[model samples]
Target: MARLTKKQKEALAKIEKGKLYSVDEASALIKDVTNTKFDSSVDIAVRLGVDPRKANQMVRGVVSLPHGTGKDMKVLALVTPDKEAEAKEAGADYVGLDEYLDKIKSGWTDVDVIITMPSVMGKLGPLGRVLGPRGLMPNPKTGTVTMDVAKAVTEVKAGKIDFKVDKTGIVHAAIGKASFSADKIAGNANELLTTLIKLKPTTAKGVYVKSIFMSSTMSPSIAVDPKIG
Candidate 1:
């Protein structure tokens, strides 16, 4: 195993061994442990007591952070001619149909969130090979694929994010930035946790939220007590 750096060792020292902290405590501690020069993203990893492989047990949903994600989300609005103005007015970074589609076909996925209409989804089906793997594909469930292009684009710009449980039953998401106040970080984390609780599948038995960890881009994770939510 690689030896820990001086900074890494120092970071670990700040966290008590085997101690599970409350949401507020973990949020503040994460900022204290972050050693990155740039503003690092504060992420939350939630381990759920469910099997993702089972269709009925899958957990996926969207949440709008109360304090908003610190980073500006680059949104692409792929819409027909009539809806272009609406999309642009809603603060979409990029707006268009054929040209954007051609760019996507050419392996140009430079944007974060892609919001498009149901009619446009048919054209996007062929480009799934490029978008699917990157998790940029617009899905109806996430409200990314909808006729209300303006609403979708606005929501995404206003800190809306979608997350799905991984194969290992962990849902990982960047809740905010380390530069944000501890209260802001904790607020975002709580919002996400509450949403996840509401989305628990009926088939999921026992402890829905098994564990939660909060950390920055390169900081040691702080264990968050699941019961605190």
Candidate 2:
């Protein structure tokens, strides 16, 4: 195992061993543990008791964090000329269709989120191989594929994020940045946890939420009470 740095050891020591912290407590403690010079991202991992391989138990949904995600989301609006003006006004960084499609075809997915119109989705089908793995595909369920291109772009820029359970049945997402106040971190974390609870598949059996962990980039994980939600 890689040896822990002095700072890492100190951060780890702050957490009480075998104690499950409440959401607010964990959120505040993560700030104290994060020692990075840069504003590290506060991430939450929820382990659910569901088999993702079973389609009936799959969990996926979106939530709008009350305090925006600290990162400025780079949005690419893949719309036709008729919608370009509205898309740009909605804070989309890149607003265009064919050229951007060509760029993606060349493996250039520079934007964080891609919002496209329903008509444009057909054109995107061929680029699925390039976008799917990156989680950049415009899915209708996530509101990425819509007639209201501006609405989609605006929501994404306003801290709306979609999450899906991975093969291991864990949903992981960055809730906020370490620079945010402890209250903001806790607010965002709670919002996500509430959304996950609402999205719990009926087929899922036993403890829907098996475990919860909160941490900042490069910080040791802090166990959060699964029932806090």
Candidate 3:
């Protein structure tokens, strides 16, 4: 309820500039400051000033979070006939035959998250053209297209936030609300950071992490000079 005084603001800026926060520390700090169940690591990544929209900065590879991301992501599973039950048990909103090719043509625009096996991707070229623009295309490079249906759906539903690199190579994503505990964001951030560090492409030149920042939906960006670069 109180604003950060000059001294407090200065200290925060200093710590932020250092940009080293563990999951526990971030969660504890946020917990003491606010009461909200929105545990999003995206917020922490944003606090570090990591943009989520850059194509160069993207969510690729297998990033298994210790705690699933907290969100109600509508899931659509595309699988063969036999896998219908498996998809349903995974809690996918919609499970279907491999003919999802026609399905996406008819209702792809409305879906939030999509999971598909290699069998499905065979017919995905045109679909990619359609969904890529909408940011809904399932690219294996981004770990969206996988043979594991349940795992994909579970991660997506659990807030497995994906970061993508745009023309500028920067990405943007949501971690949680401003009221969320810093610890949640920190954990999410740690998971994300670890993934990125591990997946730095061979083509990527010097310093994968550029700069990071965090901010609430209504707050200003808290620039984080993590010195990872």
Candidate 4:
């Protein structure tokens, strides 16, 4: 139920599928076909021929969301004796206090998210190479290292989405599923768009939030109207 203007339709048709581009690449494509400024949500949406809200999150660190990410995150928690039972009761996928430090070398790959207590930081330091690249390392700054087990697990399940501004300062995140009510997706999209816009880096140039695409897992995106909320 979204309508595209003639110019917008042309821009959308120009972009090749599955070809991700940097901001400059994106801008050049628009200028080549249409001389309009590639600086607004509408412009970016038209260029991609898809909703900007459909883009998956580009998060750098992990956090626990109050409502969870809506995806089942296999969580591995590192806790001491005092907090061991609390972790299991909170639905942690794997809970322990370093009794299985050796196991951390193996099953971590099978898990989606990893949570570690402050005390275990010393031991986990060695895993910087193994888990860091996968974005699984627990760090306090990113809110991955936490003492609260229940809060962490609950948020992971709800959709503790994470995102980082790309080199171009564009923050991307999936707003919702295509079958979701437009209003619902719109609300979520607005929330994320607003947050990223507000969190723009002082050093970054040009527009902040950039393009948004909302689409199903395998379907094309439907551009959502980006409103300043």
Best by lDDT: 2
Question: Between the candidate structures 3 and 4, which one is better when assessed by TM-score?
Answer: 3
Expressed as tens digits, the lDDT of each residue in 1-229 for candidate 4 is 8787776677567766766544334333433334243222211231111123323423233333332233567888787888878778878888885655677566446677677788888998887788877767777755667888777766765667566544443445544333333344445544555555554445444443445544333233443333343
**Residue 172 shift from truth in candidate 1, angstroms:** 0.5
> Against the correct fold, how does model 3 do in TM-score?
0.69
Worst 10-residue lDDT window, candidate 2? 220-229
Show model 2 residue runs off by greater than 4 Å: none
222 in model 2: Cα distance from truth in Å?
A: 0.3
Candidate 4: what lDDT?
A: 0.54
Q: How many backbone clashes does candidate 2 have?
A: 0
* Residue 217's lDDT in candidate 4: 39
- TM-scores for all candidates? 0.98, 0.99, 0.69, 0.63
Best by TM-score: 2
Q: For residues 106-134, what per-residue lDDT tens digits would candidate 2 score against the true structure?
A: 99998899999999999999999999999
Better by lDDT, candidate 4 or 1: 1
